[model samples]
Target: MSAEKIDLLNFLQAHPPFDQLPQQALEQAASNMDVAYYKAGSQIVELGQLLDTWHVIRSGSVEVYRRSGELYNRLSEGGYFGEVSLLQNRPSRFPVIALEDCLIYLLPKAVFSELFDSYEYFSDVVEVEDRSRLRHSVSQREDANQLMTASVKVLLTPNVLSITETATAHQAAIKMSENGISCLLITDLQSQICGIVTNTDLRDRLLTPGLALDTPVNQIMSPRVFSVEHNQQVFEAMLLMLRHNVHHLPVLKQGSAIGIITLPDIIRYETQNSLFVVSSIFKAQTLDELVSLKADVRACFVRMVREDANSRMIGGAMAVIGRSFKQRLLELGEAQLGPAPVEYCFVAMGSMAREEQLIVTDQDNAFIFDDNYQPSLHGEYFAQLGKFVCDGLAACGYSYCTGEIMASNPKWRQPLKVWQQYFSQWIDQPTPEFLLNAAIFFDLQPVYGKSGLVKQLNQLIRYKAKANSRFLACMARNAILRTPPLGFFREFVMEKDGKQSNSINIKRRGTAPLVDMIRVHALAIGSKAHNSFERLDDIIESKLLPNGRAEDLRDALELISIVRIKYQAQDLELENEPDNNIEPEALSAFERKNLKDAFQIVSDAQKFLRFKYQPGRAS
Candidate 1:
């Protein structure tokens, strides 16, 4: 082979379909490949054009548009196009344009057909829809870990044992013993599972406290029952158990208890280091003790990444761990400062609220006081409480919010009425400043205290923000301000002035922009969901975007988040401080290509957002 053909073969071997091909087939395909180039904004294949050669993007990017001129897809380096038209032996249905100056590999019709006819996997991939292809790529990344794929049903113990809430504690214990179970579900008179009592509960609530055996099981049981749907992933069940510090989770199917899963059940599937870290966090008594677990937190993060946990699972687990820290710190704070002066809700904002937190995150929190709260009287207590929580969070791995959006800032700490008014004002009159605040504050979830306070605030946001077109438009504008770090020619545009010069802050440019865009859609659709992936589900159901757009955004967010997470894990492995900034050279060939595709999706989503919410348009 000539040097050029050899390079082509190597490039093809690194990418999919071709990568799946046998070596002989791959070399033949590469040798027969003819090269073409297109200038930026130039059309490669017009709609209805007769197509023969299958075009693969060797470098640069292209935009594929439907017959109606709507964007169908974006293909970056290692991405291929023209297979659809060629396979059908028909005119091009989707037009292809160079998104940037491009290097294209043109596989002859004969070679392309031969490969497709001979290889089932290659044909299967090439023939799948774009969203399916993206999902396949994501699934491929996670396929190595059974925890990602295995359902909670697999871990459930047979014949879930239960006792009526009216049953005595002795009866519950006897039932558990008879069934060889550690826990028994407590059901109400309607036969609906209501609570759970474990051997530990039996020991602590009955044996240690010397409660009468005739006491109602309801009195001894944990009223707040945490559970999993039978079909949920095992990791989700693990997270629920870790988040709530529960030992047993009743696995329900269609509102009926089928079986139960325990901590030991999850441990059988994978390492329980994250669960242990959370357990330790809740067990820690002092700020110093909580601070000491920072290393454990990092180790947990690294382990999750190494284990092939997807971005959502890892993020949810980390957020649970983070909330544990806050919860433990609040317990300690109350010990020193006494009970709260008034009912208040400690709210986590941004990534934590979204359950998309990573190891390298800052604390974004606030307090919502009851409307009846008297600031003059209650102010000192909350101020101390806020300082205690924020300082403690900083002592742990979560640094203080750079913008001072923490509870420590009195601006963020406010009464429930004031919080509602704040949301109303931000929605009704969204200046650039308020829009910035909305981006962070809108994704709020209560971590502790009177959660009703936060609920009122969230209800106000969902009701007002969705109905206000001006606010949504302004938010859409703010969302696009930080564009993906892609230059005109589809190359990475790095940060030039920071200490981490020539690197990209993946969170800032990649995931954050995607989140910002998704948040706009979520607010526009009145979605109550906080997490980006869940919001996408709501958005998709609402049919707010063009077909496949929400899925594209989802794939983009997941890809970008995982890349950012993996980079942080790499940093931790090297014993260096983890940060969001990622050097382009540090990414593998596969990562760089997929990241470019993901970034392009973000850029496109931003454009659609701008078009969908024109500033002057009515709601």
Candidate 2:
């Protein structure tokens, strides 16, 4: 090959779709590739114009636009455009312009057609075009079959009614009749959610029992309340109701009930197989029963993967199952120990809180006792409760936190004031140890009990961490520790330990660093969102990062997460133990090539983190 063709071949081998092509095909492409340049702000392709070549950016940036002139996508070096038009042999569907002075490589229409027609990899890559993998992943989850795309708040009645748990059944029935509603949320004296009472409960526990109309509503109310977040999906609410076999479900936002949903509401929406798994979880009456249901959980996971659910949808569904396990465990715990002496919230931290949990994850949870809690008086009761839940979780496939972060650890089970002190100390002082603890503790959401305690703790971290420069600097420094798994020459960096040698722990190398850096940014921006994707939205809105960098980071995170999710799903499908470690050599050429690009994005984001925070160099 000539020197020019060699250079072109090297460039083609470094980018996607082309990188996956056979060596002979690549040489053919490089030999025929034509190069051209355009000045910054010059039009490369116009709307409705016929195109004979597929334009790929070899240098500089470009912007693709729709016919109506809305910004479609911003592309940097190695980003390709004009594939859609070339594929269809139609007019240029999206106009393209050079955002900066650009060097472009034109692949002839004949060669483009040959590669796309013969190679599935090329076809798939080109189909993404300006929409990119991020859009493709999201669209997969929001398709016609996925009910999780719509929010639960949409199904709620405009006006919801509530009655005190102390009120008589007659009073609740009268109110329900007057409002023409089927259910009423039962609240305690403090107006906190105590339970939910529905017409079914009245019919079964009151009318059919020949009980007096003046009986207390609590007598018939289901104390084990199953609720969904208003921000949660209609399908998720449906699943909760299915799991517990309850018709009335309370919708909560920020720990307070906002509305209620019923079975008919979800029937009008869509149904998924995952809901049936969740329903089965609540039906388990014993620890053995819960443990035996693990196979069904795996089945649900594999089914969703087969049905083409994206990482977000699968992760959200799995997180709900995990939380339901915790919820049911708590119910079992309460039943085993009877009523607790003091109120407390069982908080799930880390991946569970972020709603990105996969099948292979450890339990990271803590307890937040009420302010009035006295360890001297209530210590034993809480300890038993903690062990019951944690042990039950372990039995249900969630491994115990190796770091001992569970509530079973006495140090983690503390009163609200003590927990506040812990958060305050972690932020204000921020030693290496505290920063490590903060990483897990910072991303917490309550799974059961008085969740308001969790809300207060979250508010404390949001305001305090945002204002504390030293704390953020230390956090950024900690985040920079786990860099992406790519060597200086862009080769895969293999693990050196034990049986996993020569493999990469994707979580530790890819998702961890990305999530850690994003968390630092989210904290600095005072974003309360826990999931990395959600946090990126807040960061993007705040303009905390440079233009297009936020989206790049978001796309990078999503891609990396999807890779990890895919492997775990694969393991489950094969009936093997699910794991985070992945061998690059085991991946197909397409995946191996794209993984390197994703790792490079991680490296770039880490460099930005160091420069932005400056850590020790801040002075």
Candidate 3:
């Protein structure tokens, strides 16, 4: 073989399908292959063009398009195309254009056919459409573990036992004992599930407390039920349990209870140390004990990234650990300062509320007190409680919110009715100042205490925000304020000042803007989802975006997030303080190219936001 042929064979051995071929077949392919090149922005194949050659990328990149001109896929080195046209013996259905200067390898139609027919594995792998393959790659990257693929129903115990809310503790205990179960669900007068009682509750709230057995089970049962749909993934159940520190999760089918799953059910599938961190958080009795586990938290994050856990899984797990710290601190606060003077809910905002938190985060939280609160009698107690919890969180590595959005902020800590009024004003009469608050506070979730306080506030926001066009427009205007870090020529526009010069603030320029854009759509559609990806689902289902746009947004978000996450993990491994600023020179060729693509997607989404909302009309 000539040296040129030898180089072709070596390249073939490195890429897939060709790599899977036998030595003789590989030699045959290399002998028959032809080379071609195209300049940037050159068309490789036009729609309806007859094609008899299979094209593969040896270098540079190309963009594939559907019949309607929608971007189908972007292919770089080692990426193959033109197989679909050759396989069907029809004119090209999808067009292709070089995205950059390209060197292409062209396999003769006969050779391509011979390989496809002879090798079953090569044929099977080649047959998958590009878009389907991209979606699969994204999902498979994120959900590689069994806990992600298996449904909660796989571990559910059928025919969950229940008793009426009015039932006596003795009766509930008898039912649990008779059925040989450790827990029972408490129902309402109409048999609707209301609360749950377990052996732990019985031991702590009743037996150990020396309460009469005849006391109503409702008084002893945990009223806030955290549950999962029957078809939800086991990992989701694990996240729910970890987030709220609940033990039992009732599996429901179409709003009706079908079975129940316990912590053991999830433990059998979980392999990461995130659950261990959360468990340790709850077990810690002091602020120092919780502070001691901060290293454990970083280790868990690093382990997850090393294990190839997706960005969503990593973010969700970290958020759960953060919430666990808050819950434990609240417990310690109550113990130290005596019980709160009034019913209050400690609510997390921003990334924590969205379950998109990471190792580097600031605490953004607030308190919602009952309406009957008296400032003189209850103010001192909550103020002290807020200081204790916020200080504890800071000690655990969640820095205090520089914006003073913490529960300790006097303005943020307010009565439930006051919170409701605040949302109403923010939605009905949005000002620039209120719009800034909306960006942060809109994604609120209850971390501890009366969760219903936050729920009621959420209900009010959802009802009013959807109908208030002006507010949505203002939000859209705010969303576009921070555009993705891209120059006019699509190069990364890095920060210009300080030690971070020539680097991109990934959170400020990438994920945060994407999240802010998603939030605008979520509010417009009245979506209750707190997470950006979940809100995308709602947006997709609502047909709010043009065809294939939502999927593009999702892919962009995932790529940007994983890159940011990997950067943070690397920082922790090096014993350096983690941050969001990313230097383009530090990234691999693939990362730099794909990040540019992702940033362009963000830019396009912002344009659509401006067009759809007419932000200029907000005033």
Candidate 4:
């Protein structure tokens, strides 16, 4: 071969199919690829060619178009066209024309077949594209289906197109004219979505009696509503909707409308198989099994990040997993240790305890044993049980309680009297260590045993916190110390040295501080929500944060959580390391800015809390 041929072969051989193929086979295949160049506006993959050439863009832009009346958008470099030929065994879905002077590497269909006979990787490449297209088609079908489902979360699915029941007859007519929806569901305060108001409703109710377009929907809305449960399959739901001659079917779960899923979300999640893993975890049997399910969960984390799973679903799924771990661990512990003689409760003290932990963080647990009787031999049996169960948990990859906060630690595994005494002392007089301890303990979720103990403990904590707001304010000030690891202008605050050098401490500085702040607020208000997001919502609802600023705070914190999960996923790929510190530089400008806003919210909330109950002011 000529030197130019040699250089071109070297490049092609290093790229994809060649990289995977046998060296000699790759060299042989490289000889057949035509080095073609075209000027701007030249047709590359003509509309209905015999599909002879499969081209990968080497330089410049390629515009793939269907006969949509005019030129479509141009695709940039690295965007390959002609996958339809390889995957679908058909001609190009659209014509591809160059938008700029372009260089292309053409792999002829004949050469692909010839190369395929010798190259397994070449086939693998083709398979990935085919599967991806199928996946996309599947996703679109899912999206359209989910759009008809109902939800209190979002009145409609992620698709912006939706119609409301209360929407006027005239408005429905206008909406149908513009967007082509036959109907829309009317949602109530309970968010129970039902009753489709179609274009027919407009004609029968408004146009018939010379009625006004502004007529209330309740007058003419179809009371005989056809509906499907949110959990039902999209095809099943579609069939129900179609069978009833209803274009809109309100979706329900436990009588609360979560969202109006048309035919979309179901199809999307099903095709993706990323979120599919999350639903599977609901059926997990044991802690070891839950631990085994980690790979799937981490896969979900990666998929969600890549697929851009909505913040709510992503955060909600994480909280579900964290709770699942706690619940399973508690069940296992209960089975192994047997029921305590005293009324006792297992508490999740840190992230797992907070119900806001992102992905796979280490577990933090402790016990509150009832001490109604001064059981003479209580100490030995309970301590031994704590050790046995906690050790069993460690064997399942929870890691030992890093802070020894588990029931295995005598101090943490305290009697109810001792816990109450400790709480009284800490809240009455907050110290740095005490504040830290309170931050953890206060966020506890009673996973097993007597939740009443945890409840009573919270009741006492909240009452005392309100009575002595000064102590709570000091706790808030301490909570602010961790601040969101953001610098002067919204840059990530990085570690100066050590293994996590140049990384953001997501647990401590990023998420945990917000966790602490929310715990304090919840305690102050005596809110029943043990989770961070829920507590934030409670605070917002109670007007605790001054005109829904808590919403902003919650959003900011959620962004931290998303980043934490993403970081965890990255670390998992890098030797399955537990992800904690996130590299701030890895974040986008929008995310970095959001992190800064989140930290500022924490700082501001802490300051306001302090101002409300600072030592001098409190007295």
Model 1, runs deviating above 4 Å: 1-272, 616-619
* Residues 81-157, model 4: lDDT tens digits: 67566646776667888767888888777777677666555665565444433433334232222323322233245
Write the number of the candidate with greater lDDT, choosing between 2 and 3: 3
Cα lDDT tens digits for candidate 3, 221-328: 999898987657787888889899889999986578999999976774353477767888889988899999988888778867765567888889899889999999
Model 1's alpha-carbon lDDT is 0.85
Q: Rank the candidates by lDDT, best first.
A: 3, 1, 2, 4
TM-scores for all predictions: 0.61, 0.63, 0.65, 0.53
Worst 10 residues of 3 by lDDT: 128-137
- Best by the lDDT measure: 3
Q: Itemize residue pairs with steric clashes in candidate 3.
A: none
Measured by TM-score, the strongest candidate is 3
RMSD of 3: 17.4
Instruction: Give the number of colliding residue pairs in candidate 4.
Output: 32
Cα error of candidate 4 at position 11, Å: 24
The segments of candidate 4 whose C-alpha lies over 4 angstroms from its true place after superposition are 1-297, 300-339, 373-376, 489-492, 574-576, 615-619
Residue 51 displacement (Å), model 2: 7.5
TM-score of the candidate numbered 3?
0.65
Which stretches of candidate 3 lie above 4 Å from their native place?
A: 5-57, 61-272
- Which candidate, 3 or 4, would have the higher lDDT against the true structure? 3
Error of 4 at 75 (Å): 19
